[model samples]
Target: MSPRSILFFLTLFVLGITASAQYTEKINSNRPGTSQGAFSVGNNVLQLEGGMGFGKEKHKIFDTKTNVFNFDYTVRYGLLIEQLEIRLNGRFRADGVKQTVGANEEKINRSNFEINTLGAKYLIYDPYKKPKKDTTNYEALKSWKEHYKFRWKTLIPAVSAYVGANFVTSDNPFTFPDDPAFSPIFAVIAQNNWSTDYGGDWAFVTNIIVDKVTTDNPAIGWILTATHTVNDKWAGFIEYQGQKSDFYSDDILRLGGAYLFDQDLQFDANIAFNFKDTPSIFTFSFGASYRFDWHTKDEIIEKPGLEGGVKEGEEQENEEQEGEEGIDGEFDEIEGVENDSLKLEKTPFINTFEDDSFREELEQDLDERRTEERLERERIEQEKIDKKEGKKFKKEEARRLKREAKEAREAEKAAIKAEKEKQKMIEDIDAELDKMEKEQGVDGELDDIDKQLQELERMENELNQEEKEEQKAEEKKAEEKKEIQEEDVDAEYEKYQLQQERAKKEEAKRRKKEEKRRLKEEKKRKKEEEKRKSQEKKEDNENLDIDKELEIIDN
Candidate 1:
């Protein structure tokens, strides 16, 4: 391609690469910037980003001024996996070139596809795929900053690789006369996303691209972009791009911002400019990005909970059903064993005395009857023992459930008492604040104090609501535990008792801390009130003295 055409193609390539490499919950559009994110659009998602722009380029050496209009589009589809995407990027430009050769002016109009490429990108490494384990010190006595210390692992960036082929038709006006019909392009992309203490998230993306390697005039380029999420709906970016080739080389800068219209759509506007007398360029573009999301939620297998921990609601119900079925099966087996013993009792005595001896026959019959009676008695006794054990197990389970229920009730009562105390404290503070406001005539400071009191009440309500929810959760957990195996019941109950004890201790500590804080605040308020009264009295005394002095002077 000619240098101007090369420049235009490179610009389009830069624009097209700006898309995210991975799927995001919110449509991560690469629009309004010129650096590709190292993430994909996610599997089964189709995204389209397009822009139209007008530009002016002035070539000093050729004494030519060109007015350019271009339309660029990128179609990206996540395929097969979350980390892979196939993309089609193309740009068409129509240019009106005006040249002056010593008072001879010439006009040339050229229109064609300046750049077209189809590529597949795959993420090779993702630093954020797995979250780091939290290791911060959360002790009450630790400094607050200790929880937010910087993690060195965050420095690693997600990286991706892209390989694509560039297509150029023969005799295309945008290409050089000797340019090949097809060439290869390759790129390595890296991106880092980090959060600032100011609550804004920042992203930096870098792309190293080698385009048209098979062509006689190959180009190597790099793009660096820094993006900041201003808020939930707005983002801004600044980018720098540099490219070098035998045919064309220049540095370009871009600034842009995007608005998240919704989860799957974005609107953006950007401007790009280059510094060079040989061919100075400026462009402005407005674009929008939208996606057809077909992503499905991935199935997640939860890890097993702690020992003696209850399962989820549905799982717990299933477990309970299974346990009941097992108990029924055991009962059936026991009945089968009893029937087998009865079959033994019904067996006829052996006819070993074949000779017709009445005495021996009578004796045999007696002995057999005695043996049958003894077997029957033993079977009845075994049945009684089994029934007794069953009853004992049932009684134990019932007692455990009842005990847990009682404990839960007691805990609820304690919580309610604490909540009442908190509410009384809030009411007293509100009453005191009202009295102060009435006495002080509703000044700014008093208004601030009232606001603070209202805030405290609001927080108290939230805490009460949380506590109620937690209690409900605990009740549900206890109900689920009723299906625990007979062997595990005692162990689980002991563990739960220990947990309750620990929770009581923690609650006591929390109450003590709260009471201490409240007293400190009350003391501070009283001291401030005393200081204010003293100041008022001193002011009144001074006024009286001044008034007396004035009277004496008049006399």
Candidate 2:
């Protein structure tokens, strides 16, 4: 490729270790290095980093040379949460070659894209932190390698492994299709991180890789890297990578630096040097990387209420720690006051120049003063407790008194009501007596007439008794006569029956006679009427004759 094409793409790509102390993806990119660290992007996050590389090589086999212009694009996506990740770190390059045969020159062009590694990373183990009973002593906190001084990576490391394959996804420079163009890479990786006071923190990453297709020998490669935070926005690192190829064994050492343009964006650059004289290759890289979530993690970061509960959890823990610190402080003060042996060990006598007698008296005075101070504190605490209890007791007593007073008032009202009711009952009895006296028509005694009437009624009763005795004698005689009548009772009954029959017959006859007499009178009256009518007729004739005579006379 031409220098115009090579120089225009001077890009160096880098990835950050992590965003913060919080849970974020880690990038092991030193400014320009080829040592991938033992970390992946956070769960559900994506990372893209790209850069350009320029390569010039001379060949001894055909006396031909090649110039390569290339761009490298790295991609990493986290899966299965942080436990697994998928990565594609590849390069797209164009190669131009020049060859001469007996003064005739030939130029050839070859361009293709190659994936350096497409792989998955699995986490096997991570750091384990033991509980700290006393946080005040930071040394009491147990970690994996805290005992191993100066060995930073052993302190606390997360262990992981990776499996990948390198492939060239094109057909070129070969007449046949049956060629080995793919290789498998398997490796184990580890990462260790620590914090410093001034420059933030540091991380060390190491990987042991096995490349099956580097040659028929199946080469082993290694990368050991160290990262240091320059400050909040800047960081730097050094990396060492080495492997024995079929032709020569080479080692690469790289130095790089990174700067944070923003919280979400970072820029980095590095230069790499070969350690061998035979096959000397130089590499330089620089680029920037940015990160973001699909939705607004800013809401959680700004409000602390959207998603990140860890902030509040940490805050609660800090508050509890503060409370424990306060209690520890109080205990320290109390210990100083109580542990007289400590004071004595520090200074047995305040007045060293004084005589023994005087020292004794001073010590006694000091003891008394301490005693008084302790007594005062106890008394103050007691008073506070007693004040609350006293208020409670007072309220209870007031309630009891109010209840008693209410009961007494109710009992008094009942007594008064009962007295009134008793008086009303006595008055009712007296009123009834007065009404009876008035109805008697005498004030205190019955009238004399009433007594005389009673005596007269008694006398009449005696006379009635005498009349009853005479009636008894007459009734006895009538009984005797009835006994005699009983003897002929049947005959007398028969005679009475005969008389009744006769009377019935006579009544019937009288009724019949009366009926016959009414008919006879009716017949006699009819005959008399007939006779009178005839006589009236005769009289009428006579009157007619007289009228005629009168009429003749008048004529």
Candidate 3:
């Protein structure tokens, strides 16, 4: 093959291999202590996490004390499922090597970076099932209580499991007398975790990783770890890490505790024992890490069915079920009781008072009160009746007085009318008299005129001027008297008009007083009707109270 083609194929092969092993995700599980599973996407979650520690090794190389450090990281995800289970697995490791100390024994500075592991994990089971309580009785007792079991609470179990491939890249330079050029290591790991409760607060986890190294190395080994969560956020772990590489084998036992401040941040401390050496050596470690909780979308909300008060409801249901069973068993016994000489314990048709004497006393008191009330009511009714009779008498007297006054007014009106008629007749007679007198005066004047005419004729016959002048003066005097009489008649008519006006005003005053009396009578009648209705209503209420008293007595 051409070199170019070979290089292209090699690149493709490398790319494929890298693509298969490289984990791309938003969550990093290795940043701090984590539960079993990786954070994933969609219906599943994927998480990548890693951490490394560096410190001086306990070993000395020919009195040239050396320092050692380790680095490790892993990534994984979990598939969502309904059953209380999940898959879990991840890879990680610890590495120890030594670097020469400085010329001064008190101070040593060394730095080594190693990729301990790349792994994945899943959750296996929820360590604890959520607590549940039921509260069916709450509803049945609501009216009797002001406060009730308004909410129910419970906890649910959660679990997960996982498996993954692990690889470690070593950055070791062969500067010493005996050192390796490179250590290519590979591993396969399986892990499981179970959260006892819904919050993943408590958990039991176990993991094992088997390692293989391309180059024979003394450091590579199989690792086993078990962890228990003491609280929602705190965990203690014991781990066994041993190596059975082609060159040598070494084992280390570690006891550690981790506190999760959040999904992304943690603090850890550990005490480790190196068992492979002639005498076991102990080392102490303490570390703090800041992790971005990438699994923020993964929330553990308490299920309603597993809430705190849910057990009460469950208990109530159980009670009801037991009661039903008891009822069925007691049915025959209850039937047999019907034939017993003693009274059958059946539901009472009427509830008897527990303290019959007390009830009797109460009944007697009620009866006495009722009788007193009835007598009082009767007394009031009698008083009302007496008042009504008195009022009626007063009304009759008033009516009689009004009638008398009315009759007097009518009599007065009749008298006034008669007087007016008499006056009118007198006026007519006077008018007739005046007319007759006027006629007579007219006739007399005519006669006088006739005489004057005769005289005029005589004067005319004798040609007498003085006699004609006397006649003209006499006729002027007579016309003046007639005008005076007509003025007198007009004065009498004005006087008659004043008298008629006075009579009409008197009649109006009398009629107004009568109308006022009539209105008063109507108001009194309405008041009497309303009083009657009120008395009837009072009687009805008394009757009802009496009936209730009787019913109580009978009971």
Candidate 4:
């Protein structure tokens, strides 16, 4: 190509770079740490992350010293938002080795640089931040929690997996990883992020990894990271990494933080401390990511999803406002215009230069909007705390009530047991009394027999006669018992006749009393009627005598 053509192409490339820079995008990174997060930059975005670390190692047997220097640069391109990404990331490592036996010092392979790994990560599944559905207001959407809607704190982890390889580019005799070959590395990742009660975000990321570090030996490792987002611009993380190989096992703890200058750029620093050694590595990195449109502005009218439609709507509103102002201004100009064919054109800059009204409004409200967001987050945090506390209190109250009910039942059982014991004691006393009464009766019988025995002793000669008398008495008693039975039957018959005579006398007495009552009633009734008739006759005689006296007077 000619010089002029090359210059033109370079100018065109620079213009393209400027155009791409105009399209701003925000990317959440998962780098400058051991564990990978289940997230991606939006489609057609370019992200680059780079870091460097220095390490020193000491040996006791040979009294050797080694200094390791490392650098890594990773580039990621998002094929699909939150779904797929292609990454080219690798590390450049150099080691300084020193061998000494007390005073015998030797410096061998003073410096070496080798590319450590080149890998690609593909996200397989995400319980959050996947399926990329656009919220109604993208700017208003704060977190991806709503996408999951609900999650079990212990059970649901956003899961992902990726496969990659590591290749050694340099063939240095004294460098580590003597084989210049590729090693396959595969990992299954589980991650989760949650907001704490104090309005901070906490993230947990874990990886189960298998990698072929040597030709014949494969290494199995695990990485666990706990990340806390202190605020919008600062995030701190603590990580544990352990790898087991055929020869040895090594463990490391990484502590780090990232400062986000803005959504599109970040700076990070971290230190990795080995369990075998005191401090293994220290790293610091700077990274930036950007997004741009694949098509020119003239060809593409709107963005995708909700944010896309928002731009069009804002433009339409501005246009309509300008149209209304133009109509009004043109009509006023027409009233004084001399040329009938010419129409006054109203342009934003024609009359005078003025401040950008929209820009001014944005500048004025930026802090106000930030304050509102902070208050909203605080309120949400309080709600979560109150809900958790309420649940705890309810559980405690239920447990207390259950305990009380159990105690009540135990008390009732104790009362019933006491009542049963009392009844049993009473029954036992009654049985004991019955047994004592029987024993007393036996004692009384024995005393009567002793008295009879003494009386027999007083008359020894009459004892035989007494025996004969007892025998006769017994026979006589038997006959008497039969006679008594016959007499009892006769008495029973006489009792029956007496009962009949008594019953007859009672019936006659009742009848006599009833006849006397009836005669008394009849006599009283006759006396009352005769008295009434005599009174009435006397009243008539008095009236008649008066009349007769009057007649005599007249004669």
Candidate 4 lDDT, 1-555, residue by residue in tens: 234334433543333222210111235577668566655554556777777778777755656677777777777776634356676776666777788757777886544444455565665654432222323443344443642233343235567677777765565443344454677788888765554233356666778888874556677887777676776777777777776676446676677888888766778887776544322333344444333333111112112221222222544554585567643454344343222011111121122223456433542354344345445555665776798999999999999999999999999997787667656655755665565555455446546555655664466446546656865775565566556666688755654565576568657856765675566556556655655665565556556555654654453
- Clashes (candidate 2): 9
Task: Please provide, for model 2 over 144-234, each residue's C-alpha lDDT reduced to its tens digit, 9 standing for 90 to 100.
Answer: 2432234333355677889998774558442123335687889898776654323356666777778765546566777776677766677
| Overall lDDT per candidate, in order of appearance | 0.70, 0.57, 0.43, 0.56
Q: What is the full ranking by lDDT, best candidate first?
A: 1, 2, 4, 3
How do all models score by TM-score? 0.51, 0.44, 0.32, 0.44
The best-first sequence of candidates by TM-score reads 1, 4, 2, 3
The true-versus-predicted C-alpha distance at residue 194 of model 3, in Å, is: 6.3
Q: Is candidate 2 or candidate 3 better by lDDT?
A: 2
Instruction: List candidate 2 segments past 4 Å from native.
Output: 1-31, 58-65, 99-106, 128-156, 170-182, 198-200, 213-217, 247-249, 294-555
Off by over 4 Å in 3: 1-54, 60-64, 69-111, 116-171, 174-204, 213-220, 278-283, 288-555
Q: What is the C-alpha RMSD of each candidate to the true structure, in Å?
A: 45.4, 37.7, 36.6, 30.1
Candidate 3 lDDT, 1-555, residue by residue in tens: 234334433543333222211121222233223333222221344434344454434544344333434444443443343221122233333433333456444543434333333333333333222322233232332232322222211112233333333233344331222434433333333333322223232222223334333333434344444455565566666565554444444456677887777655567777766643333356566665543332322223232322222222543553474467542333333342211011111111212433445543543454344344445545655776798999999999999999999999999997787667656655755665565455444345445545654664564445335434644553454455456756787655654564476567557845765675566556556656655665675566557656655654454
Q: After superposition, how far is residue 312 of candidate 1 from its true place, in Å?
A: 16
TM accuracy, model 3:
0.32
Higher-lDDT candidate of 1 and 3: 1
Clashing pairs in 2: 12-285, 12-286, 12-287, 16-27, 17-26, 17-27, 31-269, 31-270, 32-270
The residue-by-residue lDDT of candidate 1 on 1-555, one tens digit each, is 236535655654454243222123488788887668888887789999999999999999988999999999999998877788999999999999999988799999989999999999998887654322222222421333532455455556789999999898887887777888888999999876666434466777889999988888989998877777777888888787888888888888898999998988999999999879689999999999999999753312111110112223633553474467642343333331211011111111223233335533553454444444445545655766798999999999999999999999999997787667656655755665566556565255555666676686677677767767877776666666655635587857765895697589659857965885686578558657865885686566557656655654454
Best by lDDT: 1
